[model samples]
Target: MYMRNRTLLPATPERNFQMTAKERREEIWRLIRSGLGSQDDQARATGFTVSRVCDYRRLWKFILREHPAIADGVTCEEALSLAKEQGVKTKR
Candidate 1:
């Protein structure tokens, strides 16, 4: 595939989704709070599907907006960097 094929083509590498449920949630939260991309983008980064992103989109937005500081100390840049570092994949 070429870069023009997909704009949000992960821009990074691909990582494994070998995390526990708790870890997955945390990553999802991190991605959400990161504000790097939309829920679908985050889901793809965290090794999840767009459907999963849709499922938690509302709640995730609530937490990110209403709660704040939910991602612990992980900043948006940090979270995005971590995703890139982990080589997260987009199943497109």
Candidate 2:
């Protein structure tokens, strides 16, 4: 006789729409802080291309270096906005 195990894995809900820039950046930051430093790993986790992950990583690195307060949440949305206001070139 053969028996099937009756365990089910939890599933995440599907997203039909793309994440906003803010949401994407936040997710990338979360994944980075989770300690998966490899761009490939981040891309797989975020369902983004490796190059896209690299772009977000570069943005975060720039923010951390040039504007730690923004990176650390002086305000939500300040990172990109402030960077633009400062005339820093950043790819969204």
Report, for every candidate in turn, its global Cα lDDT versus the true structure. Answer: 0.51, 0.58
**lDDT string, candidate 2, 1-92, tens digits:** 11123322111224313666566566766765444446765665456678777766666677788877556663325665766798876665
Model 1 stretches astray by more than 4 angstroms: 1-14, 64-92
**What lDDT, from 0 to 1, does candidate 1 have?**
0.51
Give model 1's TM-score versus the native structure: 0.46
Model 1, 1-92: lDDT tens per residue? 11332334242333424666666656666556445576556756667677766545544443445446654565434444444565543112
Model 2 worst lDDT window (10 residues): 1-10
lDDT of 2 at 76: 28
lDDT of 1 at 2: 12
* TM-score between model 2 and native: 0.60
